[model samples]
Target chain A: MGCDIIVEEKHHVASRTKNKYTKNEYTGLPRKTGLALRFTGLWEGRCLRQFRGRRLAWAGLVAGVLLMAAGMARGEFIAVLYKASRICLECIGVG
Target chain B: MAEVGPGGMGRIRRTVQFAALLITNGYWPGLGRIAIYSGPAKGVCVPFLNCYSCPAALFACPLGSLQSMLAAARTLPLYVSGMMLAAGFAVGRLFCGWLCPYGLLQEALALPRARRVRLPRWIRAPKYVLLALVVLLPVVWVSAGAGVPFFCKFICPAGTLEGGLVLALGRPELRVNIGWLFAWKVAVLTLFLALMPFIYRVFCRTACPLGAFYGLFNQVSLWRIERDRSRCRGCGTCVEVCPVGVPVVEKPNHPECIRCLECVKACPYGALAFTMTEVGKQGSGGTPRISNFKVRNGR
Candidate 1:
């Protein structure tokens, strides 16, 4: 009984594939291959589209926060301030 | 309330550049100590390409700071990099457009009525090479105790102008140290200045490593130019007006765009607009709110 149901499901998918290929007659791809390709393209597009609005904002925010944290932890920010505060005569070749 | 043209923005930018130059080099007019401003403010890096060696400069050049930091101990240039990152994220190469003294000089020189020539696209590659050679190589060489701020020492016209020329003019004692290096830099500056009337911002388009560095962030910077596809007529007006020759209809935020907003003002169809996203404005969708309605109103 289980085997029969599984076979029926496969048959249903094959028929749907054939119908799609027939509707777009110019594709020339085999039914299974065309279905697979379409599914892949759709999946990729969906993934990329998800990165658009809120996700991008979050990513930027996170990156900024992490960079700040790193800057602080390394005392890099202080070092920059210290360097900028002093004069390097060598930089001007005056030393 | 008259509709301002790109020329108006150019005027505004020129004024801002002049103001910045004065503020950075403010101490000289008073005649107290005309040496490099070795004050506390020197710890901060200004966004423009002002040379720190200038006797009147109040802030450090980020590139010079970066090279100095790197040459010290392969020290991670946290302050310079962080400042650059912040500036890049905030406004990208808008610094080049409205703040850089050198850019201002180029703009001023370009005012002469000359037959303008468009630079070939491939010339854009050399700035990246310069960034690598002048910035990255020195960083690597720093580990060997051979690291020098090669670009500033050899190639920077700002240093030559503000540090070399200004110092020589003001002090005259420093002229004894003037050698072939100074002459070479003067020659380079002369070549760039002569070319400016014919090719707008030739140094910026070809060899400004600092501009190149900021340009990398143009694509994702909070400050951006947007083209409303709905309004565009594909007339190519923006391309004609762009100083850097960016094809804005195709790529609205081309890295080469200095964010001078000439295209924004030049768009006949009211398609191009400047916009900015609020920092930390969460979940606001990637949609940028229109910041400049003038372009939209097409006045």
Candidate 2:
């Protein structure tokens, strides 16, 4: 009786997988076309699911902050500072 | 927590914007005379688009600074770009929503109107084109020693409103310099002001290159609005309330999202929220919350 139950469970799992593919094949496309469509759908699903992870976003922020800090340390901001102190002639349309 | 309605949030945002304007342009007194603050703090770049030449302006405009940097050298505008990037990453277009004086003006004008016209999606593309034109065309002219900040001199209504109007009014000597260019700018500013009531943030939606830059970072900014997919009912309230007309349910973190949190306040099920989190982790609800996160809606 236990052996029979295991066979039935395996059959249920296989039928569920078959149903999933059959749902995708409902358009009545050629076999090769259906396979291609299924592959594309799976790829897109994977991409959308993976795209939401926060690690890449945090990495970008950290990199941007480090670059900004480095620029400040190197005195790149000094030019803007000096320029801002004096009146800008061209900006006012007088120069 | 009770949710603040869009109107309440708008008032708070306007108050902050007004405060920012006063702080940045505090030198202006009620008297007819106006004095530009030539302080050390002026060297710092503000994230918004206040005119650098405005007599009362205390900080530099980033777009103007970028143009100047490019006009002076063919190399990349490292300092200005870096500063803007830092701001963009941290808050996205939060500065536009909360700090821009012009944005405040548009929002104020929008308040009195009963009717608003929704712009088509294609109208959003021009700002990117304008950004390219403003940054690139002037570089070539600068290389030939004939370049001006083309956008500022030719197009920016902010410069015309803050600098031109104030200078023409306060400094009689500068009045003689007002000619066709000033006239042209006045016409543009007038048109923009007239359109504000009918169309929300027309300049920001269509032509503000700074908005375009900040919008680029909205997808990855530290502060963001997220929708809990499991809880969302797709009632479409967020779309209706959004000033920029973003389809928030489909893409909550769209680049065009200004991080204004209007959708968060509008969500009936509390499925939407504003949070400080990594880009992919926006829906996790695990990060620190921004102060004033609660929005109380009036019955």
Candidate 3:
């Protein structure tokens, strides 16, 4: 049973979908890894290792979207428009 | 990372900067008359420091929007924060190097042959202080029933130049309203103008709250600079070329780096590079090493 589970795990890992760097729709290899590969060619592994925390960037993108939605829902978008459309004399050092 | 030779990279940067300026402030109603754009686009905040009241500005300044929203509703500025975060993470301070019209003006002031003022590292602290005041003063004043965009009124030289000077030139009658406050603002603008040539983006390095905010994301931004320790010789060429005086070899992802790529073009070993993807390259590092990368003069 343990051997069967090991086989299933290996299959699952192998069955992962293709990413941007994948060779083909089904194959696994870099088709377009990063600019580092195109540029230095030698700095490829370091480039990928340096980006180990790229998941943080993705999370930030999602959080930013969510915050924008919340702010718009609360009518902040109109508030921004109302304020931006008019010239506040104080802002220009006149008032 | 194909080395766009010195002239090539500079030409590309200048073109991008000029294009950004035109795109942000392109609302030309007529040649003579000046009018603020109040269209639906004004609701959207552009990533840089273009003033809202500029005759042709199509979008709101994020700093101005944040302060106004905080003062009016006395609540958290979720929208501006999110917008800033998204832009910061996506491109970091690329906007400062390539998009900010104010930065363009400073660059024009910076003559290539002129001597630069070597400011102490402590000079980097004030922008954060200004940012703090920008966020807090609005809430503080609003709670007391005197709502105001504090930084816009007191400190923003961009507003003074783009909004005040431009509007004053177009509307003769508005000149009558100019008082001590206007004079004070002009003085502030003058100080910035005088210092810029000597300091190389002094306003951006020491005063711009927007730059300060975006600087925080330089480390985690989607687009980033990477330095290869194995390849770098610690020659300090990158440090000398950096406009913001970032110690590039020591800290390739420093907060102050504007990513102008001057260092990348200047490096003899080609130790520095920028990447746009997250995928790592795994292989028998192809391409023979070029120990003496030829960096032509004027790089």
Candidate 4:
């Protein structure tokens, strides 16, 4: 039994050395790759470090869309955008 | 071996070139009014986003005109400045190199052997942040796409002092309604303009949203100035000479880089070179890489 124990320890050491020495092919993707793939336009510098970072940018985008849709669906906001654009053009000398 | 040609010569030539471009854009002949005539026709200005709105403006100033376009846009292109983005992608940030009238201002301010002031990191992000609040925020808010000219309304020392004040001072009606915003603008303008003589284009380096816009072009532009690591000695002279606060050793296409060519002027070796042919010979070949490249950042 003692000899079997010694043999078992030797096998473990051999496997440890083998694991250390082996050079595996780079088949696996790094874990961070998943995170990077998921986020877009959030972390421009990094993966979304900036203020318009994911949360705010998304909220703003949603608000902008809703505001726009509501305005389009309704009346007053429709002409206001058009009118504002015209005024802006004229002011900048393109109107 | 260095980034640009010799300091004094490259600086002078580029300065003269910038002045010529600005004049071509329209600086009232001597003040660079000529810039107005050439920018639209010439198409040589690829780096700096020139204003297309100024009556005297010959070349297109991207930001100034972009704001107007956004304010006016009622449709699908929504939020994106197609032409502007293309131009930026094509040349990256080369406009800071060849064109920018304001970059020339900082270079000129650096003259008469004056001491320069380095801005703190706390302020550097403000320009980009301001870019958001000024450009993106409004576009998102309006949903009509594109941004309101918030810089002009709230911050721009140029518009406030150069155009607004100039127009307001001449017209009484505008003066009549001049409320807190005007005073606020004028006070800021006064401080920045005053600082211009002493602190360099403190506004451009620190606060100019237009500069920030152009800085976005630094990465992909063709004949951009690049640092060849093999040739660079890691000397910090480029930083010392840079008016807009770019760290010389890193890379030229920084968001803050006005493409003034000062670091190109500052380099001791010919490591940095502005090119058009992508991988061709440096300045000695003199192919004039501009003109042909489309302003991809625009429509």
**Candidate that would win on DockQ:** 3
* DockQ of all models, two decimals each: 0.09, 0.12, 0.25, 0.02
What's each prediction's TM-score?
Answer: 0.72, 0.75, 0.79, 0.57
Computed on alpha carbons, the lDDT of every model, listed in order, comes to 0.66, 0.69, 0.77, 0.49
Query: Could you give candidate 4's per-residue lDDT for residues B1-299 as a string of tens digits?
Result: 11233254444446566675656455464124212233224222223534433334444444554454445553323223444454454454545545565555554555433335667778878888887765554455553354556665666665553455544555455466667777777788778767766665577667877567656756544335666554455546676777556665665666766555656555554445543322212323232222232233231
Question: Which tens-of-lDDT digit does each residue in A1-95 have in candidate 4?
Answer: 99999999999888666654342212121121221222222234433333321343234334445544553454323333333222132232111
Per-residue lDDT value at B190 in model 2: 94
Q: B183-260 in candidate 3: lDDT tens per residue? A: 999899999999876777889999999999999999998777766554555566777667677878667778898878
Candidate 2 - CAPRI tier? incorrect
Q: Where is the poorest 10-residue window by lDDT in model 3 chain B?
A: B289-298
Docking class of 4: incorrect
Error of 2 at B164 (Å): 1.3
Candidate 1 docks at the CAPRI level of incorrect
Which pairs of residues collide in model 3?
A: none
lDDT of 3 at B62: 96
Q: Quote the positional error of residue B64 for candidate 3 in Å.
A: 0.6
lDDT of 4 at B231: 48
Q: What residue runs in model 2 are displaced by over 4 Å at the alpha carbon?
A: A1-52, A73-76, A86-95, B1-7, B29-33, B111-116, B143-146, B278-299
CA lDDT, candidate 4, residue B115: 32
Tell me how many clashing residue pairs each candidate has.
4, 9, 0, 69
Candidate 3: which stretches are off by over 4 Å? A1-52, B1-8, B113-116, B276-299
**Which of candidates 3 and 4 is the stronger one according to lDDT?**
3
